[model samples]
Target: MPAVSDLTSHIGYLLRMVSNAVSQEFARKVADEGVTVAEWAMLRSLYGGDGIAPSALAGKMGMTKGAISKLAERLLDKGLIERTGNPGDMRGHSLSLSPMGAKKVPVLAGLADENDATFFSVLSGEEQDRLRGLLHMLIDKSGLSTMPVD
Candidate 1:
């Protein structure tokens, strides 16, 4: 007889199950705010400060420059972000969150916090902390620096 493994027995399968549930729920929550998960990530990144170059933003998000430009266009259309041009450099530009975007960051952040709490409510505080620590350890071990926006 040959040996076979159950689909549920794989660690990746388990991780994917949990990840999908968490991400889907978060996506829905943010969608209600008229922003996709990726847009939320961009907004959150820009929340730190303004005048971030598209290339720099792409690097920080671990995405391609083209992807950043696309996202910027979407955000600009939504009136959530604005583009700034350099005086000396005609082609040089940067992105910053608009007034509305700045106000929405905290609201979206609250939703994120609530979603996480609701989803992980089954775990104790200590358990949640331990889980996060373990996940961080795994991320570091695997050299995974890209932000999970999808």
Candidate 2:
């Protein structure tokens, strides 16, 4: 008979457990501000830019074009983002944050900082830096550029 592996002994399982806790906590906090993590990612991506192509934003976020379009529509409905015809490509539109979105970005970012601090308060600054570095190293080694969103 083959031996049965214990899931609790796996590093990936431990990582997922912690990741879920952190992400869920952040999700709740951001929901209080009327957005999902995905929406937050979209807003953050558009914060400082002049306009970017939908395809570009999608690529940067590691999301599909359809997902980007849906997020864009929601932002447009909220008047947080505006779409303008692409100068170089008439068939395409560039998306940019509206003034309202520009104002909200900082507030949302502050919430994000608070959420992270709340969850990671147990860790010292050095520990936090180390954890981040390790995670970045893993991401680089694995070639994992996908944005975490739900």
Candidate 3:
């Protein structure tokens, strides 16, 4: 009789195992920068853009409006972001990074680079490129555009 397929043999299991490891390590590294992984995602998404409403950011980040408001408030408390009335809509407000956040983004981005390098250094350059291509292909195929924060 054939043996039953094991969880370890599944691609999703393997991918998730690696993902959890990479994410946990990255989270630890970024914690020293005074940012959680979710915060990093939100901050990075807001980095290059103008002020955006919480509802708009919610759509962009694949999160809820309430969650965006909570994050905005936390970042505001940290002095990392500022919120102002939306010029286009009186009912909504727009959010953007503060000068301090703008300065910290590059530093946090460098940490991300270093984390990737450290974790994937075992792979050859060709292997790295191939892995990236495969992942991007999978992402495209799955229509997954959300920035993984959780």
Candidate 4:
């Protein structure tokens, strides 16, 4: 072989290292609040509206209908979301945040804010902004539009 690049020299490896650390810590923090990151994302998405159809939610979250249905069932069982039948369609329904979920959303959002702050506390403000810009550039260039729920 002429030359082999070191694993540490790969940007993907470096990104994954940091990403895992950030994601794991955030997952633990959210877990304490009785919700996973994916559930939180779904709740947050519903926060902007009164309700949304399952198909619409699946499209918005870039998830399959089956995945959304599973998540919705879990949230419903947990009493964090409510379902209402559509007026025109007897079989159609929409999901919305329950009063409990609506209340928990702000608290969970605070945790997310704190998590970001603590994780990036090592970087200077300017450095953090630059890093975000670079990441956005990469996302935009790659046309990565799917929401990262895992």
**Number of the predicted model whose lDDT against the real structure is largest:** 1
**If scored against the real structure, what TM-score would every candidate get?**
0.96, 0.93, 0.92, 0.94
The sequence of per-residue lDDT tens digits that candidate 2 reaches over residues 80-125 is 8999997788898999999998998898899889988988889999
Enumerate clash totals for all models, in the order shown. Answer: 0, 0, 0, 0
Per-residue lDDT of model 3, residues 90-115, tens digit only: 88788999999999899999999998
Error of 1 at 36 (Å): 0.1
Kindly indicate the candidate among 1 and 4 with the higher TM-score.
1
User: In model 2, which residue pairs have backbone atoms overlapping below 3 Å?
Assistant: none
Give the winner by TM-score: 1
The residue-level lDDT of candidate 2 at 95 comes to 96
* 33-77: candidate 1 lDDT, tens digit per residue: 999999999999999695798999999999999989989999999
lDDT, candidate 3, equals 0.91
Mind giving the per-residue lDDT tens digits that candidate 4 earns over 82-133? 9999989998999999999999999999998998899898999999999999
Assess candidate 1 and give its lDDT: 0.95
For model 1, the superposed segments whose C-alpha errors exceed 4 Å read: none
Badly placed stretches (over 4 Å) of model 3 are none
TM-score for candidate 2, please give it: 0.93
* lDDT of every predicted structure (CA atoms): 0.95, 0.91, 0.91, 0.94
Runs in model 2 with CA error above 4 Å? Answer: 1-5
